[model samples]
Target: MGNDGGSIPDRRDLVRTKAKAEQADKANQTRARWFFCALSKRRLEEPIVACPLGRLFNKDALLEFLLDRASYGADGAAVAGHIRSLKDVKELKLTANPATKGKGKGRGEGENEETPKFVCPLTFKEMNGAQPFAYLAPCGCVFSLSGLKSLSSAKEKEPGKEGSTTPEKDEEQLELCPQCGAKYSKSTDIIPLNPSPDDESLLRARMEAKRAAEPKKSKKRKAADPESSDPPKKKKSSPTAAPTVNPNIAATSRAVVTSLALEEAKRKAGMSDAVKSLYGDPSKPKQKETFTTMGTFTRYA
Candidate 1:
């Protein structure tokens, strides 16, 4: 429709224009996760350790966070407070990428950067968190999950190999590490790096259950280690224990006790006969209430 004495308004002209905000760059986000400490946000360096949640951190940064949690502020505590000690994290045995090793390193340089600091020896894929990665608990060797499966599949394909036969469901089947040839259990050793929230919860539950099942030697450790053990309890002496003798006295303890009894008797014997009569003879049975009755003290009306 034509506007009276004016140009017809187009849909674009009618709608108010709004500037769209730029979203975060995916490449930068990926690089931040793969190359920086999740806690300290500094460039990742050795000796690096990964949490049960799969996030990576510098060992020194974790130590500092543990030592003074308040310094990192609230977010740091929430990010790493789950890490109570060094035992909570395992040091990763990472293979340096040969492509990047020979080149000089510079901080904050863009694609000008040569390569990812580390890579999977099996697939040669850079550990940039683009794909799944895992580390073995026993050997601490890291490898991409796809590479591990490929190696496993390759073994199974070998003719007459035991892996080619039916797999065993043994609770503790020891598998050799492809990288180091170290023995590890497949069911428990393979820990995913930087796992998703759901996977992290499962890993955390498994960790807690395993720890709870573990034979707690902390009580024993405290008892055995002198520095950690409580001070030895002292033996309590009885009140009637062997009479103590004055160090300056030449007489024995028994002699001192005997002398004290004799003196007490003599002092009583020296009491006047009238004063002594107030107390009846010890040989006679004591009256129920010579001076006062224990009950019914109110006088009869």
Candidate 2:
């Protein structure tokens, strides 16, 4: 068994290809991110969405993944754990790649025939995660930065019935999306795709300012005090005195009053002496209770 075309290779004898392996791994990762959905491991398709972490996804595929996370296997949680709902990722408005004739499969026989799925609708530039792109926050229409600038420049040069517009007017005006014609404030609506640190800071500041500008709900007022605010209504005096009763009627009224008084007196007479004492006669003097113990204790003893 001594070196018979087989020998136990020592660690030093083996080739140290760690650097090549790392490079290959990096290349594969880049390709995967650009060409495949990060969540589904399928070919990227519109409407594509990107998370805050810059991972790409197909919108429908992401939804499916969200609805049933177990369907994508154990790696699903690791890949799309951050996306709890639709708000976690922005739905990308992709510009169709004009160079891409059709959706051709990209493996095995026709690997070279595969074309980009989308491009900047303005300059017809390819959007394969390499170029600088932007989207309108209001309409979500994606375009290359250069293409957008060109379009803006063209707009500025276009003569209106009045004449060429001023730069100040341009800053104040709203920009309409070419794709959807949605009106968006140019100052705040343009959001860069895969924004840099500075761009993200500016976006955050803009968002804060927008939120601050919104009017807060005022507290509901308590019910009004109707009595306090209103003046007391003056009661009207009678026009004439009440007519005097006939002698016969007056006599009958007096008789009824006398009978009621007599009944009340009879009721009082039947009441207990203790109850009667509560309403004692005013003419009677209250009896003074003398303490006789001092005199009686010595004298009587």
Among these predictions, the greatest lDDT belongs to 1
| Backbone atom clashes (below 3 Å) for every candidate | 1, 0
lDDT of 1: 0.73
CA displacement after TM-score superposition, residue 18 of candidate 2 (Å): 12
| CA lDDT, every model vs. true structure | 0.73, 0.66
Query: Worst 10-residue stretch by lDDT in candidate 2?
Result: 215-224
* Candidate 1 RMSD to the correct structure: 10.0
Candidate 2 local lDDT, 153-221, one digit each (tens)? 788777864246678878788878887898877777777765666875676576555544542211111
TM-score quality measure for candidate 2: 0.49
TM-score per candidate: 0.63, 0.49
In order, what is each prediction's RMSD in angstroms?
10.0, 15.3
